[model samples]
Target: MEFKKFKLFEQMKPTIRKEFIFLLFAALITGGCRKIFDLPKEKDYLSNNINFSNKIFEPILGRTNLMGGFNADNSTMPMKFEIVNARFGDGRPVTDLFQKAPTYVWTTAYNGLEKSLEEIEAKRKLEEHALFEIRSSGEFIMWASANNSLIKPRPADSTNFPQDTRYFDLKITNSGGQTVIKDLQVRPWRERPYEPSNDMNLYTGGPAPDPDFPNNPNTRDYIRPFMSNVIGDATDVNLGTNDDENDVIVYIRPFTGGNGHSLRFKVLNKDSVAINPAAFNETKWDKLVHGFNMQKTTEYVQYDVAYPIPLVEVPTAYAPGGSRAHAELKYSRIGFGGGRVVATFGIDFAIYKKGDWEIVFHFKKDNPKFQND
Candidate 1:
């Protein structure tokens, strides 16, 4: 029996060794492997309550805060009453006062309160209410005895009388539920107008009989104005359909000699479209440039040049009287252009003589067409 047991032990020994080697190889191959459980669920940071409140009431509350505030006097007494602890049918508080109250309520509640505080402060400082009574001819006067304690009585013929008074008709309700209907008036306190020594009418061009231009007569001659072509020979240039050509003209008119004489001109299209600054490209012959030189000669001659293509700038200059003429300008194009350019040109002449200056201008229409957009 002992011999048989030994022989069985010997047989099982190899089998056991084989199993140990297989287990060792398997452990080496899967040594770093790990089992993964589900990660903890992520938490949401934003709550629904905060989002709902912002969407509904934030904007309304912001406007209410701006529209209603303490009066200018910093008084705790609110000019307008806000109903607290109030709710709508849905149990939401009333945050908007502008929509709930009438239109006049806004001005009366806010503006009226401000004005009342200002008036009170002014009366306290200057010892007078700047209140003025209205007269039949739209004039105003500060009543002497009415504000006597706060203000001294003015003479019956005080020159500083109020000239223009703006009155606002309003009805106000206080927090205490007291209603007051009143007319608020603003007084205009402006300086006196300087009266001229001589009568000068702007409608008719003439000199005033003052010391500056004494005995100076109106030398301006109203002539039949003609559109003179100064640059290119385009007496009958046909601009293609939906296109335009520019021509410059110098208008010469006589006037009393003065300093700082100059002219300003503006062109308007046929459809009453003002020539926007872009049509004068350097490559286009349709655009024109103009200049005037009085120092070179008494003649107010205008030099006009037409560009074969549209240009960005035009070179030009002008002078004042015959002695020291000093004026300059550069014309440039702006905006897209299409067929047919109809323009109205305007000129304003400014001339100074004997310490006096005069201004005049001519209004004329010019229409020229081109072929493309």
Candidate 2:
């Protein structure tokens, strides 16, 4: 029996050796295949320290809002950003946000140095885009078309019901790797197309408030002016009694009746009567703004030109920097002893929404003392 077992083992030895050799050759080919199809490993990676300056967004409807606050800790520049899993609090998809619609986007870089509306128009082009998206620069954009009705509603008292806001995730990627920022919040409010909002809330779209723009005027008043500077000394006499800010209030009102886009400036007195534009003798109506076809009348000074006062925010011939539309009204009045006091009432203002707006300067104290003492 032992001899027969030995004979069986001897017979199986050649078959077992052949099987081992075949397996060894298969392993060699498998190892060579890896070398034959070598692939390079990714070198770049997403930084764990990535963060955003502003995580929450509350953009008003009726205008394009570019909400950008990305802080790439150690990540590579020009990183790609994509919005994914945009939905309501209940996990329902926000389909309209992803759908492309008509939008006015700036193609040319706005250095704030453009002189005319023609130059501004050359930069801006009306194109189709998603209601909400992340741009290549990691800036989040909420298009004008993302009206209040399409988004998740924010109740009048949403402090108690915070879940009414929209939620979205961001997928930031590079050639190396990608990371998703989850559960970003957005609460789109109703559209208040213009500023000094009558009903809608006035919000600082950025993280910090501009020190220059201390406060937004009440809806009733566009700007309440004070004595910025007195050219000459007339302290002994009450020089027009411009003591209070409400002494002179400017009202910015948009109107439809005009040849085309226009802006009209007028002055009013305490009695709500129109002050003659001729009273401001020193004010060069032609150079006061970038508007053309100046029409000076007893009631108001109308200009038939661009919709926005300062085509660009920069300090060109019209506005100062910071995208604000600035205008200074200058007039001289004789003080006691025939001394002239050139008082200047200056206002730094901005109008983002396009319209034929009228600025009415109401003198609450008294009609600007244009009479010689």
Candidate 3:
């Protein structure tokens, strides 16, 4: 019996050794997996709430607009962002978005103190950029090369369908792994060029859609508001969409001739006659802007200045808000109530295109009352 038991133990020894070796190999794999990754795991580290501030990306044609305000709560830095599966609403591929085009890329840091357009242009170099691309940290840019032919927006007519509302997916990758954000909208419209672009909407080169008109004593000024009251005055000061009604319309006209780097301001009364700049007694024409060599005429007031007003969007002696160039025109006189009434017309504007531009403030209904009632 002892001899038989010894033989059985010898046979079990081989199986036991083999099992031990298999368990040891499995433990080595488990230990090696623990030391594999340096960064956080995609599920563990990446925030589930990472999203955009605005869902609808409405990029105006002929210009680059930043699609910013990405909320990445507790997400790792240097996370790669990519635009993927871009297509139109009709399920067609947006191949043009992937193609590269010439773009103004900043070579050096812009301090906003650059004097001329040439100086401004010098700091930037024309580089090939994708029409629609996302930066690694997730700031999406719609390049100026995106035109109406490529990305069509909702037309001015209500009956027309939105031809091409581009849709795309965003892929964000970290060291651990990648996660994809699905189905982002890109609805682009035509450019209105300058702001105070209230006159047009769904700007499809059609008869301006639902024009926004403002009343006299223009509310553009928030500090010292305009005061006006005419009891017996018969001026058409109605701010309406009526074709006949004439509100003080400010027209920005660019000229290719005679000192391209200049801005001239003109005011016309109801009868198509130019108003004397002296009539606006309260306006400090010289201090109104940061222009040099101010030339005032009975017909117009000219300023030899930089092409784009407020060269950089910073609060200065010229631009108070660090955005648009603000101009307030004030003229005071006695009213029917024996009180000092002031008629003020203020405009805040910016010119992007480089040329001699003229701003005409036409009081269409009638001439402003400068005489006591």
Candidate 4:
């Protein structure tokens, strides 16, 4: 009986080994197939939903706004974006998606309107179109001006649509060839009756002739006026009865610099203008005189030449009431050699009242004399 049992056990062992081997082979086949066909492919490695971080953006008509950036689930994969279709609220579609438009961007801190063309050129760069391409990191930005939107919205209608709305359709494609469509909606910031015109409430002390500018009685011929933060109207501005408390006056002058070649500031309205101090009435004149925060700096240039000197820095005063509520600016410089040269310089002045005001004095000398002193 023992010998018979041993024989059966030996035979059963081989059969058990065969069954174990078959099970192991099945598992290997299953795993190999999964590694080849069941594994995820490039197409599966995409965002389930791709969109813009800002679905709706509000931008002022003449101002620039950064519209939106991409929001993707798969940031690791390279992506590209293009404006596939753009339409305004009225259903007008953009004819050309690749057309570039000229748009201005603010690169430097706004120093009021005292900015020079050279300074603006140096600081700001233009974007040719409303929509920009995606950045290297799969992000996109929209630099647009309201008047020049991708899809120019219909003119605002108070009765119909007070606030204008615009629509943008973008196409995004990943490196894996998977594509996605995203949308952006833009609206004008606010809707109110637009002012037909604003004069910047400019009030002058009356035009006076600079001895050097005999051809032109007003320096305005040589200087361009840039006003900032001016509100209300010139008719509404009042210095009150107290000249001491309400006197707000500014004077701008141009003088000869060290080389007798460059034009600079002498009195800068901090004092009375000796050339024609009595030109303005006492009521409009400031009793006190103050200097600029930064004085004009430049090298002398010859006469009849256009040279730009940086404007002085002035602080902004919103809604009136400040240390400089009532101040005066006067400018004067002398050159002596029978008016051998002419030069131009820009000066900046700040004042506060119902609002802050910045005035840029653009001055040019038709002729200047060389002075030894």
Candidate 5:
């Protein structure tokens, strides 16, 4: 009787243990399901559903011309000029301005000329003998202007004329199907007026002369002007020009290093631009030029004059998920002569320990008129 009782007790213990284990497992499963279901749909799956990533909308290659001309029909006039030469920040030719790379330079030439013949004639005379010229033999010319009337013309004989004429001796050579120039100039036009026609309230338009700030630890005070206006608040508010299918290639490089840096890219939209308290206000149209963040490095960095730095180090792990970095790009009718928009974007990178990372930022066209096939 004692043995039978012991055996029965042992049997009951095993059954109880099995039941406890099964109950625990069931509870875990139920809890897991509940937690999963309770999670916010947007938080758990929105990113996957949205498919937001830094995608290369357009990869520009080879020598391309960023041309600009007089457009009297829309009352637009050229305001700035630039001659960019491509080289790695380390002074190596990753591409050439005249041979490869996108046109990523900006300058000012005239303002208040996009209104009437009187304005154009007045500005033209001032421009022709303005003593400022951007002459380059190798670099392509990409002229941009603002439509503001407040911009005053530089003195006809001002010795301090803002001109970028370093293109006379510019040389571009191709090796391995890439441009390799030892020395090149990355200068923009200096003397020009500002127009305020297409300026947004969130941006202060002007040339971005400094590309090392905000990314280089050694240098600070990198203020990216909202627009390319060198005059009063009323400045040239027009976006740059780009023919359909012609992607704007922006080359991003570390202030010191040559290559192998990760870049972060982002695209802004009309709502993002308008609501950005760090950029625009409601009263005036702010021409918020793009911004970039990069890792501070001690290497010599350069850019390919041919491939304008499209948001640098695009499609990386550090990219802002969901939403492109160039969705806010829209052509400014106020100055777009051949149907182009003044768009803005930003970039960020990190240059720490070897094999570190860098980033880039800019706007991109959703339905760019390019051929994939």
Candidate 6:
């Protein structure tokens, strides 16, 4: 009986070993081997979570932060983020032309907001990739224009399709191949004009003389703001469509070798020329700003605003009679900003020959309505 039992135990050992081998093969096929080997598992750490400060608001004309306080997480993996598509809440597409990182119209506040090509280039060197870098950390920016970009959508014009309230979506992806989509909405930039009751004039090509001149003891200080009103017209045109030469005209009183107001202007068009006027009207002045006026052929008209010393009250120290300050219009286009090209209208003026010159009025693209100070 002992011999029989030993033989039976030997047979059972072979069967048990075979069963163990079969179980190991099943574990391998079912990914149990990954646990056995303790290999690092690919992690999906991306989540569909995001936050923005303002869900609905107007995008400032130039470059502005459309949304703030953005939050997201990509745990254990590097991720990439971008605006997958932009559109209006109305379903109209906001083209890629508006999405490319924009170059700023470097400005200093004076009459309005001065647009400086010289400063644009200078600031561009300092500003390269700064605004775009914000996207990596998670924020959405927009270049809003009722009428400035090659892109056809304008915030104004109620007859048009996309009137206001622009919308867009963001796409985020992680290294482990997970994706999430987020949505954003911004009020499109619109015209905000000041009312007449506020003692401001919309027709600022040339404003009325100060009402409180003598009554106000400090007339020089008081009148400066009112006289500092900008007088000009600007628009964002589509030049590529018709491909015609457009003119930007800035009316100026020439620098006729005196303590008189000296005018200097520049442009960013196909060609530019400065013509000194033989005379200018002191009393009834026209409000046409010296800059690009988009013709029917041109699709977009971009204008800049710069305030010069108020045309009122010339200094007592000038030559009695030089050129009776006639309207001389100067126009030029040296270069353009990369994104949402807005030509900041700027002019440097001097009381004397290139001395003590300063920017008078700066017309900001963002402040199109030309609000009163």
lDDT of each: 0.26, 0.67, 0.67, 0.37, 0.27, 0.35
lDDT for predicted candidate 6 compared with the true structure? 0.35
Clashing pairs in 3: none
**Which has the greatest TM-score?**
2
Measured on C-alpha atoms, candidate 5 has an lDDT of 0.27
The backbone clash count of each candidate, in order, is 37, 1, 0, 20, 100, 42
Q: TM-score per candidate, in order?
A: 0.17, 0.72, 0.68, 0.36, 0.17, 0.34
Off by over 4 Å in 2: 1-39, 107-120, 144-153, 156-160, 196-222, 229-245, 305-315
Query: By TM-score, is 2 or 6 better?
Result: 2
Model 4, range 328-355, lDDT digits (tens) per residue?
3322223345432222222232221111
lDDT string for model 6 (175-220, tens) is 6564545456555332211111112222222232235452553321
Task: Locate the minimum summed-lDDT window of 10 residues in model 2.
Answer: 202-211
- Model 2: per-residue lDDT, tens digit, 272-359? 9997888777787777777666888889888765544444445665665645566778888786798886767756665555668887
Cα displacement (Å) at residue 71, model 3? 2.3
**Candidate 5 lDDT score at position 73:** 30
> What's the lDDT for residue 237 in model 4?
28
Minimum summed lDDT over a 10-residue window in model 3 is located at 218-227
Candidate 1 per-residue lDDT, tens place, 1-373, comes to: 9999768667777879679678877886565233234344333232111111111111111011111111222222333321233233334442222122211111122111222223322332222322332222222233221222322222223333322222232222333333322333222211111111123322222322333444566422231212221111132342221112223322322234433332222333334443433432222212121222322122222222111101111222321231222222222222136334332222222222112121112222334332232
